[model samples]
Target: MTTTGATKKVLVLFSGGQDSTTCLALALDRYDEVETIGFDYKQRHAVELGQREILRQALTRDFPAWRGRLGFDHLVRIEALAEMSQSAMTHDIEITLNEQGLPNTFVPGRNLLFLTFAAALAYRRGLTYIVAGMCETDYSGYPDCRDDAIKAMQIALNLGMEARFVMETPLMRLDKAATWRLAETLGGQKLVELIVEATHTCYLGDRRVRHDWGYGCGACPACELRAKGWREFKASPSA
Candidate 1:
């Protein structure tokens, strides 16, 4: 459980979005070895997988010290999960508010499954940490993004696997604006710019349009939150 004076290895549940990219930067800064894993669950925003690869290359080029230490970038195909889920993120349906007032984009059991699989992968690879970017603030009302849910999932994962794997959620309480600030603090202005330019957060999967915040369709919940966060961040003294 303790990683003092020893090489700390971590597996990041990367999604190639602004939040996850920031988490990756933080992992690179804190851990001795870092590897990233992304899920392909046939989501509408499949472009994120490509963005993950692009960011990985850019990170490797910018932070050459992580060249060898950054282990293999694994992209797991879980299309069966998508087929079983009926969320707007996976199915070709209009996004709406569910009866529970949650966004239709909420995929049930996604974070749970993702962490479980990541924990297994980490155990097999001799890693003891799993990093994720789930945030409760400025989010789309996804229950899995909550801190308590993640904590329970972490406990469950450890108990189920009989491993002491730590699940790290660096953005759990961070708002979008605060997330931007964290990235800037962790990797400087270059990283902030990289995220704004390269990361994908649009649920509609529209990348042709560019905004001061990032690329998105500008109407989806994800884009609205990102744009609002960028505006607030820019107005704050930190910007």
Candidate 2:
């Protein structure tokens, strides 16, 4: 899982949420050099950008040996995209089922744009791998989170860039419970605790309320799924 080139570097599309933080831990474990990038797309949960920095600093402090191995943390500001889309995530709208039966939280082409930007950053930095945390198992009906969509985007990105770029989705098939297990496997229980306490995932963007699963508004779709996963994982014999 190590990088192929001499730099041994990879770019991670990190949002400082549960899944992407786990992806960051995975990247650090596999690559000699890992740089994380976050987007400030004017989402409702803009607090995630702050969480990203917190996790970045925590990783450096907790894993001192990985100080040099962990590279830059880029927070790209693209608020124009938020202006162009209407979603519960980026817009102050009601959370309800759309006409397509999808949740209003599904931001159109968010992952696609995120991955594309990550690829560009990786290309500029002489890195070939772009790691993301998009998962089909717990995608919550986001079309862009599907494995087929990722494969197609990978092909298109490689073709457009005219470079052999690897788009790695480590959690593409993992459910929330399995993702919790992965966090433990990557950095043990401390990492799990960090994710639960520091990551932001509420569609309502409320962090004041804390739960066993994490901090969120508790009633949002994101919170419900996360809580359900945590409960299931904790009840399991392995957990």
Candidate 3:
């Protein structure tokens, strides 16, 4: 969707990961004003939380065009969400699929709650769009990340808040490799390098060893997907 005039503003659901970082870049490119919001749910990879500020600083420092458009960064603490889940992401446990076939890393109602809170923040901030990094093409099988779920959330938020808020998920259909290509398309190799060096996606929160894709334990689902995508992206003819 095209946005113009004062309404060309967005609030990104940024989590300092590759997907959210790419989405942030896209929002800055497409919108006149852009704000970001992150959550601290006391996850295992809380290190990702720390990377948010560093990534924001790098974006404004390296990309001059996005500097003025980038606005406030809001962080919310909802520890109760983690307390309600005993999943691997919320606790120190194995990242395995449960009997229902969904991975234990799936924190139930995460995206739902995130969007609800984000819509509320956007309402107060006078933002028109809510951009997120949720993807279903190459994900851990989280139901909330699906397109239909996002659409439903948009309707619910708009109806509940009595405001017209558009939800944009740029990575909804793109896989990990395509997501990397999107980063390059948005900000060239500089953005890709920034993502590799700065963004954190490992579920285990291990950053000691640095790989081409970034720091991770290399065994968790997150790292594996990132590694595979990086390799595929590098192998692509255009890359």
Candidate 4:
């Protein structure tokens, strides 16, 4: 069957972060029905889990156009990932580059397992598309977030589940600045404000110190990238 929004519903891997919120908005704009799925992997940034509900409420109140198209939201708790991972994301250890040259924040198989669980959920929910915000651009070198990895996961999910589910990565090629631009394009400044105010991206889960981009610790890699992106986004003529 042809993959089109008119005929297909979507399940978004929403973590209540800027990138995922943008992907959710894209899914809402493109699909007839849009559902959201979030993982409670017991990461250090657990604050984002609560922001999911806040974002949902804000979306319902601010963006009436998408409120009706929004479907059930699913929060899956996978503690096993935390149990197996000693990464900075899963623990309170310092965030730094490892001997392999990759950041210690890299939780192995995170995106892979996320796609697997999302595909399984989609199979049960009759969703044909799985939208995620896994971006290689403006990110801390996560191998699982690469386009090739996502495509391979799509193939593996289809073959393993005997189902055809399209994996949509709207921000796959866009940097963080471009991501912000896309959010403005989709819902204008309202969406951008919603993301900046409501979404959470700080790995340390710090919400006290608010930056122009959003609430983050400002020292971790996540906050640094977000801050840099927000500055660039604002400086751009299109923004």
Candidate 5:
């Protein structure tokens, strides 16, 4: 399916954070109509999802012109993994920050499950594209978030559903610095800053102090990634 003409429908797995929010902006520019689905997924910090909705509301408000052009669609929630609760994502395990390989916070098969659900919904709605915020470069290193995994999932999704759905990863190759650059180009630096400021990325869900770029608990993989990216951004402002 060629998305060459007017108003291609795009479905974004929005988290209302810097990466996903930037992806959302990119979708708006490319697609004719954009609809977002933010999943709660029984996460320890449900506040992230709340921040997602808050962003949807804020974006629709700011761009009142696209109030109808956009879609928050719905904030869906799914049950945590039942059997093994070793991960803080599903059970009461403590989610750590800055460890090394795949922290306990890594929800097993999360992106896979979320994409499956989102793909099923997109199929039902006859949408042709789906977007995610996962990035391998400058990442906290979640194996599932890699482009290879996404491609594999896309193949599986198509074979399973017998439909062609392109999973767009605008931030796939780009590190945090490149993401900021993309956002700056697509939505302006201030807009990107607003996206960072308004959204929440802290795993702990602490929105206490706002950074020049956005909110952070000054802890967790997400915070570390954001801060690292900000340092990169500061080092290369033009980017």
Candidate 6:
């Protein structure tokens, strides 16, 4: 919590993606002084930029209470990562929509790197809360997105920074379907659907199919997972 007695100054690790967009909404609802942090991180394309900008505009335009809490940043370039091999994101390799599951689109150390940056930013701001959108149930099986990985990262951040930093993963236990439901409750069904339309999550870089759940190549693991979740969510009562 902050010393201002306004609860804590929470920083969200936002990416302008579907999950992160929802997390941003959740943070605004739960925190008194919520500040979102979206990074460039040298993604597959400018999709991150597009999504971040849309969310930034949407938050200030739609949510009057959170008008000034939206913050964004860009990383001009990333070094020493090109030779690290392709993961469908930075390469031409076929993104697995495979039946065996687990896709190669999993970028190495992605969550860990993002969380580390988020922790550093929160620590500098004297805040203890960092929000992230990670779910084990409906994901590409990125091992770092799990609860155990987050717990371990929390410990490391505490030890490294000498400050008790709490990484908040509200979507950790919920599947993609449940995520949509939460977004609807936090904001509204229409607003959540707006998020899906604006955010980006295409590993194959397909910006054509703009659904109410983010962009999709309609074939990769990410698109498949998101599409399937939405189908199930639309059918479920809680949706």
**Pick by TM-score: which candidate is best?**
3
lDDT of 6 at 233: 80
Model 5: residue 83 alpha-carbon error in angstroms: 7.0
Scored by Cα lDDT, where does model 4 land?
Answer: 0.91
Residue-wise C-alpha lDDT for candidate 5, range 1-239, written one tens digit per residue: 24687668989998777888988877776677788888776666667776776677766676544456686476667765434445665466566643555687786778888899899999988888998888888786788999999999999999999999999887888988788888788767656767777777777767887876677778677788888887897799495
Please provide, for model 6 over 1-239, each residue's C-alpha lDDT reduced to its tens digit, 9 standing for 90 to 100: 22356565788877777788888887776676666676554557457666786677887788787676655443323433434746666767765643446566677777787788788778777778988888887787888889999999999999998998878888988888888788888787766767677877776667977665567777777777788878878898876
User: What are the Cα lDDT values of the candidates?
Assistant: 0.88, 0.87, 0.94, 0.91, 0.78, 0.74
Instruction: Answer with 3 or 5, whichever has the higher TM-score.
Output: 3
Better of 2 and 4 by lDDT: 4
Residue range 101-216, candidate 1, lDDT tens digits: 99999999898889888988898899988999998877998998899999998888889889888888988878988988998887778888999899999997889998988899
Query: Which 10 consecutive positions of candidate 6 have the poorest summed lDDT?
Result: 73-82
What shift in Å separates residue 194 of candidate 5 from its native position after superposition? Answer: 1.8
TM-score of 1: 0.96
* TM-scores of all predicted structures: 0.96, 0.96, 0.98, 0.97, 0.89, 0.88
Residue-pair clash count for candidate 3 = 0
Which candidate comes out best when scored by lDDT?
Answer: 3
> Model 3 scores what on Cα lDDT?
0.94
Which residue runs of candidate 3 sit more than 4 Å off their true CA positions?
5-7
| Per-model tally of clashing residue pairs | 0, 0, 0, 0, 2, 3
How do the residues 14-92 of candidate 4 rate in per-residue lDDT, one tens digit apiece? Answer: 9999999998888877777889999999999999999998888887778878878888999999999999998999999
Deviation (Å) of 32 in candidate 4: 0.8
Lowest-sum lDDT 10-residue window in model 3:
1-10
Cα deviation of 180, candidate 2, in Å: 0.4
